[model samples]
Target chain A: MSAQPAAVPHLEIDGVSKRFGETEVLRDVSITVPRGTFLALLGPSGCGKSTLLKIIAGLETQTGGHVRLDGEALDGMPAYRRDIGVVFQSYALFPHMSVKENVRFGLDMRRLDKAESAARVDEALELVKLGGYGSRMPSELSGGQQQRVAIARSLAIRPRLLLLDEPLSNLDAVLRKSVRVDIRELHDRVGTTTVMVTHDQEEAMSMADQVAVMAEGRVLQMGTPEAIYERPATRFVGGFVGSPPASLMKLSRRFEGGWRFGEIEWQMEPALARRLDAIRRIEVTIGLRPERMRLVEAGTEGALAAELRSSEYLGGERLLHAAVGQERIAALVGGHLSGLPKPGEPVHLLPDADAVMLFDAENGERLDP
Target chain B: MRSSTPLLFLLPAVALSAVVFLAPFAWLIYASFKTQGAGSLLMADGLTVKNYARLVADSYFAAAFVRTIGLSALTTLLTLVVGLPVARLIATGSGRAKGLLLALMLVPLVCGALLPSLGMIHLLGPLGVVNGTLKLLGLTTSSIKFLGTTGGVVLGLVQAFLPLMVLPLVNTLSRLPRDVEHAASSLGASPLRVWRRVILPLAMPGIVAGAVLVFSAAFTAFVTPQVLGQGKIATFGTVAYQQAALVLDWPFASTLAVVVLVAIGLALILSAQFDRLLRRRRLAA
Candidate 1:
């Protein structure tokens, strides 16, 4: 995630920066991915995640940085000289070439023996579960099949590093789920240093061993998927990771005994209050996971009171959205629950103290626990 | 799904083709079969193969036929050689730059044939800028006489039809997704290999369109060959013009016209097969 400085890491990216004219797409980013690790660069569009992957793949030149593959400098090495594999978002299969021809291209480029190339192409196709699809043109195949062909085409050369750029974005939700597993399986079988860039957090969490969350030309945080989910380094990371997302309660001033959100107050521990006293009049933001916030009976003691606004049935569970003062908060209630909040009804919500996440009100930086 | 016969909608186009193209072409074909009756008359009852026989027996017509195909093929090749890279550059350019590049490419199309033919003459003719500059540099003393050469006509034709090549090429190459090239390059294919193994094969349709357009333009060319050839280099078009105007041999002229038209038609039809053949060769390699 960060600079591991291991005994020759697989891929070492040192302070890479990319600038196009006046705009800086990536600013001074560095990371060391261990050998045989699956890393995901997770970010929204325009966050420079794709650019970073392209740089690693040598498809793009970094404005200023050094990249090393197993401790060898990548400078002055053209794309053809670098042993890298890239699966583009569009699947970029050659429409004119048959799947076998497409897969054999890397072998032809390397000028490998004809017999060897054929065997590798067959093996790569079979690895992607596209064994009999060798003779079909890319246009004749479905989207999923084309994606697998692209994967096979890259893997045929036995690349030193594999980069996938939003590889499953083009597939439907149902297809995406299957292809995601295929990618993970392919990674497990190849055991190469793989870097994938995707906008979907669920995809990164499920597929990658290490996830680097990027924003505004910077890596906000890089950690194990569990670490990223349980303890996000920044408020953006916290808000971006979870579905139905976390609810933010804005507190301008802290009372003598408790944290106050307008008229609502939650009593604070002495040690916790002492730790939070460093900040003055500036607002404090508390992030509570929606699932961790339970809906209780109205007028319950030590609970935040809110008026129910709406309820949505989500097949597995129903979600209740309620208004606390001017802000809106949502909570999921499991099926077969006894009581459900109805619109215009008063509801009480309780947040676990240990599950509360604190962040700076303005900058969105996570305050230490 | 509830529509009437589709031929009903196509009847207007069919009628137009029959009146404008089919009728005239049929008459031209019919006239090409007749033999000379008297001094300057064409007789319909002869129904002879004499005109076609003349085209085969006479080396003058044979050379003209070869010249037409050769020059047309050369022009198409030269245009693709010069245009593919420029079109690729234009395709990769930003939106505004793309518009500007397209406008610049369209200059020849907008100005018509006369301007470029004249420009070619002024640039490459005997006393033109090219020879003049060469003379001043002490490279040569006399006129280069490019005015009546096949090279001059080919250059003139390329100028006339280059925009045709660029238009479809830019359209096709721009619509092509760039990720394939990236994938190829990342997979360790050199730039040349990427172009040959990926870009070129993928761009075959555009190449065919550009080649056909440029070939047809150069093959049927009259003014450029008339002005540039200056009666020295004879093509099917120039020979047909001469047979019709000077000798007043209508039958032979029709014969030359039909042969050139059929050759063009064959080239267009065979180009699809040529594309498939090229694909097969690449796959084998």
Candidate 2:
């Protein structure tokens, strides 16, 4: 972590943990979001991302630790007193109220003047680009439209911190793509310190300034998208952050200074070579991105012999599913790789040296750089 | 084929309804206009509004009509005052708590009206448990009169009609999304404000349905008032019973019955109208 004199973080989650009876849902999870920064709590289902978000929102209380907003510890404060706005996965719009009334709810609760509330409602509606939708009911709107109304309702309150939990998950694929952009633009315009929870890697990578990848009950990695993607600190993260995840292959130490797997020997980079002494048997898994693996013409140095298992024709790229010893791996080939070897045919697999990531097979931790 | 099969499934219910509901209602409307002895004691004999006219002129019948309406209104209000919170509690409580509370609420529902009245009489009547307790506590010198009073009748009606008011509201409240309350709270609304703006409006259908059901049940309550009133509190049903069974004026009794039926029918119509109006407003909003 760089010491850039962090701006008084708008929100701080310190050692926050939650348990439902005997089930530990969140375990000592902590995150900090500076003002106007978009932080995404990204994780697979049952990973406690939503639980953590709910705790920060005060919808669910943490069993231990604390959450602070704008420097005030949020102990014993109810969700309403916390003044944080939340957009739920179900949108949670008041089905009985009109769009305008729904937008004005928080303002009404605050006892703002009618004229002021109306102005804020209009402004927020326009911010979500649904200005003329005030008179409509949520049931009359499309799913995406309802989601925008929910966003507008929260934004109308002018909350300092906004939380969204899978707000775009209900939309169709095309709408999800477009709504992601809308959400990013909305965050920029509103400038609210925002925290969103999503399972979609693409959505998190594209929209979040800081992506916190969580698994089980803890955050495995938290960094900028590029940092989390290109140099994942953990094997779970390297496998989670990309679409066609990083591949793993088992290797053992050779009698020589290099590593050997099957009948092949490969020299390690200096940094990786030094760590080899600390590693007992050099039994390690090599992580490689599919895009990083190359299908070289036979006789290439530093390439392992393999047999093609199957091939898939993606629009702009062909994916070759091949096997090295009993381990299966995918390699992205050119769109016109019609001459690629058929299943059961011999092939050579080469790992781009710079792209290969090594993890301790026993612990699944990324080898320290 | 699919449509015809469903129609076939519906045919028996439709036939039963025509025989059970429509036929009786048609006969009641015809008998309302008939003369007393000339009418086939079981069926209509003549077409006349004389019985209705006589009912309008009779002061006893008029008072009973007013008392019936007033009792129904009071019972409905009291039931709402008691049932709403209980229903809300049952709706929001945990599964075990809801089941326990529902069972407690249903104790009154399953008890026969006469049985409850019998219980109340033993508890509230002169020299009964309440008077004895009051006397023992130094609150009273002697047993107090409770058997022949309107208060006893109203209390009995409230007990009899309470489940009708609560069940529908509970069903409605259970179906209401808890998200609205969470949304309101997240937006800085107080608990009271959330109930006022979100929960109450969403649960209106259930509330209205419960109120209507309570009012209808209390209006026609027979045994509770008869046993509790002990001949003093005269509601519409008691008046009809007196005229037909005691006074032997079959025509006047039938008139009172017809009037009560009309009033209940009007209430049902109003209930339907209110439900429709609320639905329309919901749609419009």
Per-residue alpha-carbon lDDT of candidate 2 for residues A1-369, written as tens digits (9 for 90 to 100): 223246656788989988999999999988888788999999999999999988888888889999988778998898898888999999999988899999999998899998998999999999988989999988999999999999999998888789999988889999999999999998987788899999999999999999999998999999999999888888888888886777777888887667766666655446555656566555887787888878887787767677888888898888888877677777887778667777999888777777777788887888857
Q: Which stretches of candidate 1 lie over 4 Å from their true place?
A: A1-7, A254-257, A263-282, A299-301, B1-17, B35-46, B133-143, B275-285
Can you give the lDDT of residue B81 in candidate 2? 86
TM-score of each: 0.91, 0.89
lDDT of 1 by residue, B94-171 (tens): 979888988989888888777888888889977789999999999999878788888888888877888888878888
TM-score top scorer: 1
Q: After superposition, how far is residue A120 of candidate 1 from its true place, in Å?
A: 2.5
lDDT of 1 at B74: 93
Model 2 chain A worst lDDT window (10 residues) = A1-10
Can you give the lDDT of residue A338 in candidate 1?
65
Q: Write the per-residue lDDT of candidate 1 for residues A244-304, one digit (tens) a residue.
A: 7888878656545456777666545455455566654357787878777777765555567
DockQ of each: 0.54, 0.73
- What value of lDDT does candidate 2 attain over all alpha carbons? 0.85
